[model samples]
Target: MARASPACWPAPACCNADFNEARLERYLVLAHAAGITPVVVLTKADQADPAPYVAAAQGLSQGMAVVALNAKSGDVAALAPWCRAGQTVVLLGSSGVGKSTLANSLSGGTLATGAVREDDAKGRHTTTARYLLPLPQGGWLIDTPGVRELQLTDVADGIDVLFADLIDLAADCRFRDCKHSVEPGCAVQAAIKAGRVDARRLDSWRKLTSEEVTNSQAMVAAKTRAAGKFTKKSAAKRRPN
Candidate 1:
């Protein structure tokens, strides 16, 4: 039961379209859903200047903890505060972001590492399964396979918490159901135009909100169908000769 999860991302020498802000925000939402405080760990800092990557990550949330380091250097002491005794940390990121390497550094385990493609910066799935290893500081680390896609379901509360600022701003809109698009007295839109909020962030919030609603409805429908099938099967068994 880890209370903290470090979401890893590689600080590439050049811009990597694969690892974008939207993807990172999704990870944050997932972490919040799981009641875990996420630490944004930007790996491969030695390959490039980590300042830009660090700043980008920090900008996603207020007072977010971000660490940039060379995971292979075996000097991940900056993460020790979260890896203290009795605590557990899970490594989460896409393939080739140095999750395995970071796991090795923290837990002293020889987890296999892989190389990323020069073209896209994506890597092979080196860690095929999830593992829970003990850290040197008496804590535990859960290393999971790199996730290719993260779908939002049953995380409405988490999303609300992550985007609290936007939620608050939306409350000021003239209409209770204002879509914030071409609506009169739309606080969100006003903020975007006034330079109070980043338009991209507003877009991200909308996308995540829509996705969460759709996925939640689908899940409920699936469960209702499953329950109906089970009830019918029970009725059939009771009516047997």
Candidate 2:
């Protein structure tokens, strides 16, 4: 019968980038939109060269802080200030992005993590629930179940900050409503043609925008239906005042 008020906190406190740069875009987008001001601490540093990962993330995040974390070595404190008190943060990324591993590192203990088997491409999901663990100094770490598909929930306001090039180009488009696709005066397309914008980045932006629209629609529908169903009985039991 009623719409819930908007949440004022960032969620899932941990985010894993893995090999997907686009996913990081979504995560950072969500973080920035929530006013969380994320300091990205990347895990699984020993698995591969994290320099490229850092570079890729820097490209998406501009000046957002990013640190390569090897939890086993106890280097997670590099993200201390962000995780300090007076803040609630969420970790989001695909499975095996070391969400749990980093949590264990921050909390200082052995949390379960399934190693990637020699043959199978999937990893064992060790974190079955989302829980907040208090940091030794202060603050909390909220670890979540690794999601294969991160449907954009509340990050629409962050697209511009996360994808600044596209935003800047749109400002210069001849037509105010330029769609970036074959709209004659679309500056985004012009940038793409001139090698000023990476086609892949443009495509990623399109894909994320589409997914955000779809996810927003789906969430609204689901919430509306649930509200209707849950309140029907209440209406019948209502007493005249």
Candidate 3:
């Protein structure tokens, strides 16, 4: 789950303000949940100044590695640390973010790359499937198709760890289950008012937390139904029919 270098590639002409920060946060949470060291890699650095994007990505987590590089160039030495022997890295980003091109650069293989639309910068699905390739550096690379959406299920610990600062603040609240919304003595709300915490981040935390709970419950219900069906079939078989 280690987020290898290059999580995003800015648009060629200008910085894509439309880049989904929430989606990127979800990816980071997923990596943390899987116990992988997440690194944010900003690709297409040669086209524009990557300082802003780098800062934004770095702000996602304290001390998280953020690297900006021209993936089209064969020199990816900055990523060598994570691409070392015995390690495996995967590229996860939206379509047309140059995941395939980076994979080709890392593996020295000619992976099919698609051109982005001039009007929208959206890319076609050149890579329709996931492929595990051997990098010349002796590590492994998993190149996957662009992800439209990432669903979370049973990842409560990951969400808590990702939002550890908020979690810590919540511990000091008067009520153990304080929702932080209009709840008296809510430490989180106090921090937000004092400008210590970004209100948007708190919103992101609540969204992910609620989504995980809903999805986890759905998964449990599905599993229970499946088990009941299997049990009924076994009982019917035992009836000697």
Candidate 4:
């Protein structure tokens, strides 16, 4: 079943990469949970090898479509097969990754792409600012901000989707609650036993999950503190009356 997701995280909030992978991945995962399937576009094709990146993304996203081409004058029509009526696709990427270039191409080569600095090839952000571009054919694409750090708060299943292999292996642990640490009959351990699942993948999943849980707790605490302060301010204001 499609998981329940909140709308606070709009599609436009995706990170291209010039920012941080963890952040971009989080936003993308949220979008996925929220029922928005993203087309992973590997920008800066001239500079970066889109193959390895797309390969990793496909492995993480599981059946999600990823297309890599020069957005400078490239057409997204090749990616059209994946789109259907009333779908929302967001373009996320780093600054020099040519997000605008691809957006312009998708927009029929009319969007004035914000140019990046030559010294570092960094674009002036706030250029997109959550603008929704309509595809002449159908559907819409949301261009979002450049994300620097993506802190996980409510992403447990998203991690599983991003790391399906580890999750699938996790199910068969000797104990249902095996932490995959060093259990006697841990399925994950057996994979490590069979030399199939790399320990790095498990480590990455654990790191992301732990960090997300911690971040969620801290955010809740901060919100409580802020609410207390706000309540105090309101009480003082009412006293004058």
Candidate 5:
């Protein structure tokens, strides 16, 4: 999964303090769980300092590939490795991060582009539909509308993969079921206190875990409600009255 965001893209601060952090981390978590290779691309690099955003993104997923580019420059050849022949890459990110622009550059399609809101740096939903197109470099590009909210489901494996380093540290904890929070013998916490691991990264891990559980439960509840509705409808239709 290639997760992208603009280097200096503005986001609704009241809605979410760090828009890129929240969105990019969620995508990375989901992608890792699905065994997908995550490439964090910071578009509009030419417009702003891509370093901090790139660092923040890389911190979320160590060893993951990250790219910074000016999408409009049509110089996305850096993404060629993923767009190789017979390979299919899906564009995933919020609106205005340049998925459509990148798709156009790679696939030679004339998709409409939109300007990001000056107030919040949010881009309009330019790519309204999902479509697959042939890449000039011998691959397929699936461009879909920018998602407002990305609710993760059944991504336990991805979490493990994303936080493998922390997981490895957790195994050395004195207790078998260490929560890694306020545990006396928690190696994970030791690493944090020792400046070996960023406290923010640990917080991110915990946050994502909680979100997955919450989302999974919500999905189950939704299905249950839908099933109940169907059952009632079927019973009513079968009634002689």
Candidate 6:
């Protein structure tokens, strides 16, 4: 049930688009929905201030852990707790985000590195495959390639968990099925009007939820068509000449 997702958003017509931040938010929501603790690592902190990104990541979901590091030389002891005995950690990020560099640092492996383009800050795929390594502390590290396209299906649970505040606000809406778009007595819209909620956060929730429904429907339709084709083929095979 996979579909091709757009590489860039907002302005797909633009020559270069950076959708990493938005994708990161979606991933955080998915992680929370899946009951996995998310640790957001902002690499290349030495090159520039990671404060803004760290702040935004924290704002995505309550109690999400975020760390900024130079990956190449930063102290990784902060990540030690997640590497405790019998614990398995997975690193997910876009290409050139320093996942490999951090993985090498933590696991003591010389994973190759690549330089990001100066113009766009995009990097080549240095780590083409996934690797499992033993950490110095007593756990396992699974490093994967940076994802380019991620689609969500039936992800309302994840969105609900991440946007609990919004859900609570929606509970006070005038109607149980309020769409929050031009609807009367919409508490979510009221929160936006009162500056209590970021308009962008509400938009993200709507986008994810709508996309999930669309993806789910598409998947179901595809499966139904496939089953129909299979039935037709089976009937033909059973028909005697």
Off by over 4 Å in 5: 1-19, 221-241
Alpha-carbon RMSD, candidate 2: 5.0
Error of 1 at 199 (Å): 0.7
> How much is the lDDT of residue 97 in candidate 4?
54
Worst 10 residues of 5 by lDDT: 6-15
Better of 2 and 6 by TM-score: 6
Task: Give the winner by TM-score: 3 or 4.
Answer: 3
lDDT of the candidates, in the order given = 0.81, 0.68, 0.79, 0.63, 0.75, 0.74
What is the TM-score of candidate 3? 0.90
Select the stronger candidate by lDDT from 1 and 4.
Answer: 1
Answer with 4 or 5, whichever has the higher TM-score.
Answer: 5
Q: Candidate 4: TM-score?
A: 0.76
**lDDT for 29 (candidate 4):** 64
List candidate 3 segments past 4 Å from native: 1-15
Clashing pairs in 1: none
Instruction: Quote the positional error of residue 178 for candidate 5 in Å.
Output: 2.3
lDDT of 4 by residue, 94-178 (tens): 5455666666676664555666677765666644476777766575666666654566787766776777878888888879889
Candidate 6 — which residues are off by over 4 angstroms?
Answer: 1-20, 238-241
- Poorest stretch of ten by lDDT in candidate 2: 1-10
Cα lDDT of model 6 by residue, 1-241, tens digit: 0112111010010012332457776777666656566777777666666677677667777776777766778467777878866676777777767778888998999988888777887767888899988889887787878677789886778888888999999999999999898999999999999998889988888888889899989999999999999999999999999
How well is each residue in 139-212 modelled by candidate 1, as lDDT tens digits? 77888898888899999887987788899999999999999999999999999999988999999999999999
Worst lDDT 10-window in candidate 6: 6-15
